[model samples]
Every structure is written in C-alpha cells, then in structure tokens.
Target: MKILVAGATGKTGIRLVKRLAAGGHTPVALVRKSSDTSSLPDQTQLRVGDLADLPAGVCDGCDVVIFAAGSGGDTGADMTDKIDRDGAMALIDQAAESGVARFVMLSSVGADDPDSKSDLAHYLQAKHDADEYLKASGLTYAIVRPVSLTDDDGTGDVILGRDVDPHAKAARGDVARVLADAVSSDDWGGKTRLMQTA
Candidate 1:
C-alpha cells in the first residue's frame, strides 16, 4: 500500500511512518520544510511542503492518507484553526482530488462531545470539524480519536471503538500502530474509531 504520512516529524507520526514501512507498505512522509525529518525511517519517501502547498498529483498512487499533523502550544487558537482545522480540511480535499482511496485522521478523543469546554476546546473543535468533513467527503475514511497521549512504549494491543475511554490514556506508539492497522483493516473501513486503554 502507498501511504501518505502527514506530520511525519511528530512523535506518533514518526512511529507510524516506521511501522508502516516495516509492515511492507510504502509511506510518503508529508512534512513542512521547518519540521525535522532526520528521525523518520530512511526508507520513507518525503513530500516537503506545508499543508496548503500540496502539489497536483501529490498523493498519486497513494491508497491512504494519514493526517497526523497538529499545531498545539502557546501559539493560541488561531494557529490551531489554521493547521488543525483548515490545514486538515485542505488535505482532505487534495486527497479526494488525487483519488486517494482512504483517509485516516488522528483526532482527539473529546472531539465529538460538543459540550467539551476544555482549555483546548479550539483544538477539539478543529478535530471535530475535520472529522465531519471526512465523513461527508464521499470517500473511504477512518477517524481514530485517541485520548491523552503518553510517550510510553507500544504493546501492540489496544481497544479501538467509538470514543476514548474516560479512565484511559493511550501511548503514542500504540496509536500510531493502530492507525496503520486501520488502513489495512476491512473491519475499520469507513469507520471512526475512538481508542484508549482497556
């Protein structure tokens, strides 16, 4: 399978890239020029550009596009909107245009609950909006909403379903692996899975 790995520099993103390659799939690392690409698996192909700068046929021959890019920090909600909301939406449109068969979005767990009024509500809202867009995009898609991320090791066993469990926090590596598996899972096709620990 040809896979597009957006935000390939992030913690989970890098793991996903490596895991995808090791799984015998070709992963195209999509990253902005400013992102550090050294940590990515050497076998991964790179597409260097911002989310808004995707070229025509950028995702050509790619079976799946995994959106792992995110903007979170002291940069405020506007940046979140630009990268998380608009950027994600833009990628979805491009993937659709490129005829990519599947899209797997790495969204947050709280994204679906409209009543979620956390300090990072903007981030959640952005993911929510993106999730809806993917659902309506008329394409095969899977949205994986994982809870508070930990840098802990992956066990290769995870619970994946409709919402993140309140009592669990997920390891970043585990999430990445799950997303990769989702791309290949017939049961996960066109499904939005929320993942957390058992």
Candidate 2:
C-alpha cells in the first residue's frame, strides 16, 4: 500500500512512517521545502508541500492518508487553527477528491468537545472540528486520539475507548503504531478512540 503521511518529518509522524515501512508498505513523506528530512529513510518517496496548500495530485495513487501534523509549542494559536484545523480539513477534502481508501487522523485525547476546558483548549477544538469534518466527509476514517505523549518506547499494550483513563500517557512510538495499524484495518473505521498506555 502507498500511504501519504502529512507532517511525516515531525516527532510522532516520523515514527509512523517507519512503522508503515516496516509493515511492507510504502510511506510517502509529505514535507515542506524548509523541513529537515534527514531522519526519513533514503528511499522514502517525497512530496514537497505544506498541508495548508497541497498541490493537485499530491495524494494520487496513495491508498491511505495519515494526518499527524501539529503547530509546535513555539507557535501561537493562529498557527494551530491554520494547520491543525484548516489544513486537516483540506487534507480530508483532498483524500475524498483523490479517492483514497482510508484516512486516519492522529488527534488528541481532549478533542471530543470543542468547549471542553482542556489545557490546550484551542488546539483541542481545532482537532474536534477537523474530526467532525472527517466523519461527515463520506470516507472511511479513524480518529486515534491519544493522551499526553511521552518519549518512552511503546509497550504495545494500549487501553482504547471513551472510558479510558484520562490521566494516562502514551509513548510517541505507541501512538504511531496505533495510527499505522488503523490505516490498513477496518476495525477502527467510523470510530473515535482515545488510546493510552495500560
């Protein structure tokens, strides 16, 4: 399968690309011209563009799309809305336009409610709006909302669903693995799951 990974050079995104590669799938890294992609594999196919305005046919021939991009902590709220919300919606639109088979989004644990008072309320709201757009976009989709992230290696034991412990944290690798698994599997489709380490 040829999978396009938006923000494929970011922390968790890089891990997702690796996991997809390990699973015998071709992971296309969607990167910007200024992005330092040294971490990506040498043979990883590159699509040079920003999520905000991807060129036509960027997702052509791709089987799945994973949106793992985020405006970094160094950025402000506007960037969050631009990239996380608007950019994500644009990707969902492109996925539908390109006729991709599946779309998986790497959302956050608190993205279920736009009005929720999560610490990163704005970010969560943007994600919530994007997730809703995906759900109604007439495509098979999976929204994997992981809890606070950590640098620990994946344990491969995750607790998933709405009633999960909100205080838990998931390793970046673990979240990446789950997002990759969700891409090719139908079990996670049409569902929004909050995943955390058990």
Candidate 3:
C-alpha cells in the first residue's frame, strides 16, 4: 500500500511513517518546507507541501491519505477552521481528484461535541466539521477521535470503538499506533472509531 502522511514532522507522524515503511508499505511524507523530516526513514518518500498548498498530483497513486495536520495550540476559531477544518477538506478534495482510495483522520476525542464547554471547543468543532465532511464525501474513511494525549509510555493496548468515554485519555504513541492499525484495516473502512486507554 502507498500511504501519504500529512504533518510528517509531528511526534505521531514520525512514528507512523517509520512503521508504515517497516511494514513494507510505501510512505509519502507530506510536510511543510520548514519542518524537520531528517529523522524519517530513508525509504520514505518526501513531499514538501502544506495541506492547504498540496500540489496537483500530490496524491497520485496513493492508496491512503492520513490527515495529521493542525494549527497547534491556536485559540482563534478562525485559525482552527482554516488549518484544521478547511485544510482537511482541501486534502480530501485533492485525494479524490487524484483517485486516492481511503482517508484516515487523526482527530481528538471531544470533536463530536460541537457545543462542548471546554477551552478547546473551537478546535474540537473544527475537527468535527472535517470529520463530517469526510464521512459525507463517499470516500472510504476512518476518523479516530483520540482522547487527551500524553507523552508517557504506551500501554500497547487501546480501547477502540465508537462513542468514547468523556474522561478518556491515552498516550500519544498509542494513539498513533491505533491510527496506523486503522488505516491498514479493512474493518475500519467507512467507520468512525474512537480510541481511549484501558
């Protein structure tokens, strides 16, 4: 399988790229020019571009497109919508245009609740919008709404299902591994699965 990984420089993206390549699948590293991808495996292909500026043919011959991009820590709703919601939508458009087969999104747990009173509600709303768009796009998609991310060691075990617990959280590595599994699974096709710790 040929996979395109957006946000390839992120903590989770790096792990996803290495594992995909190690599994003998072709991995495309989609990153902004300013991001550091020096740690990515040598076999991984590099594509320098942001989701908003994804080049024509960026998704060429790709089987799966993993969306891991975001405007990190931004409180502004407009920025959240632009980079998270609109950016994800843009990638889906390009993927469809390029005939990509499946799309997987690394979203957050509370994203399904647009009216949540959390401080990050705007960010969650952006992800919610993006997830909805992907679900309605008629493309094979799996949206993984992971809980609070921790840098702690991974448990290797994850709770994978729809309707996550309100107080759930998981290690970042665990979340990424689940995402990799979701992308490679036939079972998750066209399904929105949430992830949480045991």
Candidate that would win on lDDT: 2
- Tens-digit per-residue lDDT, 144-172, candidate 1: 88878899766877887744475688999
Alpha-carbon RMSD to native, per candidate: 1.6, 1.2, 1.6
**Please, what are the lDDT tens digits per residue for candidate 3 over residues 1-198?**
999998777888887788788889899998888888789999888887776666777888899999987788844777777789998998988888888788999998777776677788788888998999998888888898887877654888888875557577777778778778878689888887778877
What is the Å distance of residue 135 in model 1 from its true position?
0.4
Which lDDT value does model 3 have at 161?
Answer: 77
Which portions of model 2 show Cα errors greater than 4 Å?
A: none
Please list all clashing residue pairs in model 1, or write none if there are none: 161-194
TM-score (all chains, Cα) for each model: 0.94, 0.96, 0.93
TM-score of 1: 0.94
Error of 2 at 34 (Å): 1.1
lDDT of 3 at 95: 87
After best superposition, candidate 3 residue 1: deviation in angstroms?
A: 1.2
Candidate 2: tens digits of C-alpha lDDT, residues 2-106: 999998998898888888888889999989999988998766899988877777888888999999999887778889988999999999999899999999999
